[model samples]
Target chain A: GIQVEQSPPDLILQEGANSTLRCNFSDSVNNLQWFHQNPWGQLINLFYIPSGTKQNGRLSATTVATERYSLLYISSSQTTDSGVYFCAVASVYGGATNKLIFGTGTLLAVQP
Target chain B: EAGVTQFPSHSVIEKGQTVTLRCDPISGHDNLYWYRRVMGKEIKFLLHFVKESKQDESGMPNNRFLAERTGGTYSTLKVQPAELEDSGVYFCASSQDRVGYSYEQYFGPGTRLTVT
Candidate 1:
């Protein structure tokens, strides 16, 4: 089984600030996704970057497959950004199903 | 297009009681999955369903958990005589493809279960 670890287990930031979260995997992965779990317990899909880089609004993510790590950047964060961000990956050896293995997550808080 | 949807936003039951959760994936999605986070732990895969067939269920905690996807539509997860350890948020996700080559999963609002 592959291990996924996320850094900065907890963070607090003022509104309009910027932040970066990192995820490190122990093995190569065929699938990787970043999610934001809002206070309402809704898991919102942020990005699906198995490799390379992509941006969506104020959020962006980059994954270095060779290094087995991913980075998520949040710029000009707003108070609504307060939530838990998760990075989940499915190892290349996971076979057909490729069920996701989730990280502990980074709890982000943005205050006004 | 509608995203994945789950039934019973929250459930509270006593230990040893039976409970069933339902998930309806997005239309046209062939891959449906179930995962859960227990006691503030990381979310773990419970199973995967490719249409009406069970692709994998290795993540199921024990025999008390049973999942079924009939007619290649909605899926149901039944827990017979649930235990306190089962208290957590259960999430259902669906993807348009087999989960590789850029196919991403869309999650439903989780169902929070509290077993007393």
Candidate 2:
């Protein structure tokens, strides 16, 4: 089984601050995704970067598959961003189903 | 387009009782998946359904959990005689089956299950 570890288990920041979250996996992966579990418990897809870099507005993510790690950056974070951020990956050995294995997640709290 | 949607946003039942949760994936999606977060732990995969067939259920905890996707449109997960340890948030996700391309999975608001 592959292991996914997230850094800074808990984080707190002022609104408009910036932060970066890291995710490290134990093995090679064919799919890597960043998700935001909002206060309502809705898992919103942030990015699906199996490799390379991608950005959406104030959020960006970069994945170095060869290094088995990924980084997610939030710039000028807002109170609405206060929630759990998760990094999930599907191992190459997962076959065509691509069932995701999730990390414990980074709990982010943005105070206004 | 509508994203993944789950029924009975929350469920509370006594131990040994039966509970069934439903998930309706986005239109035109062929891949449906079930995952849960138990005791505030990491969300774990339960199973994957490709259309009407069970593609993989290796992650299922035990025989107490049964999942079905009849006609390949909507799916249901039934927990028979649920145990206290079954309390958690169950999430459903869906994505298109792209052969050579990797597609992002969209998740529904999870169902919070509490078994006393």
Best-matching candidate per DockQ: 1
What CAPRI class is candidate 2?
high
Candidate 2 lDDT, tens digit per residue, A1-112? 8899999799999999999999999999988999999897778999999899999999999999999999999999999999999999989887888889999999999999
Candidate 1 lDDT tens digits, B1-116: 88899999999999999999999999999899999999989999999999999999999999999999999899999999999999999999998773343658889999999999
lDDT of 2 at A102: 94
CA-RMSD of model 1: 1.4
Cα RMSD of all models vs. native, in order, equals 1.4, 1.2
Query: Model 1 over residues A1-112: C-alpha lDDT tens digits?
Result: 8999999999999999999999999999988999999998889999999999999999999999999999999999999999999999999899978799999999999999
Worst 10 residues of 2 chain A by lDDT: A90-99
CAPRI category for model 1: high
TM-score of each: 0.96, 0.96
| lDDT (C-alpha, whole model) for all candidates | 0.94, 0.94
- Candidate 1 backbone collisions, by pair: none
List the candidate 1 regions with Cα displacement exceeding 4 Å: B98-101
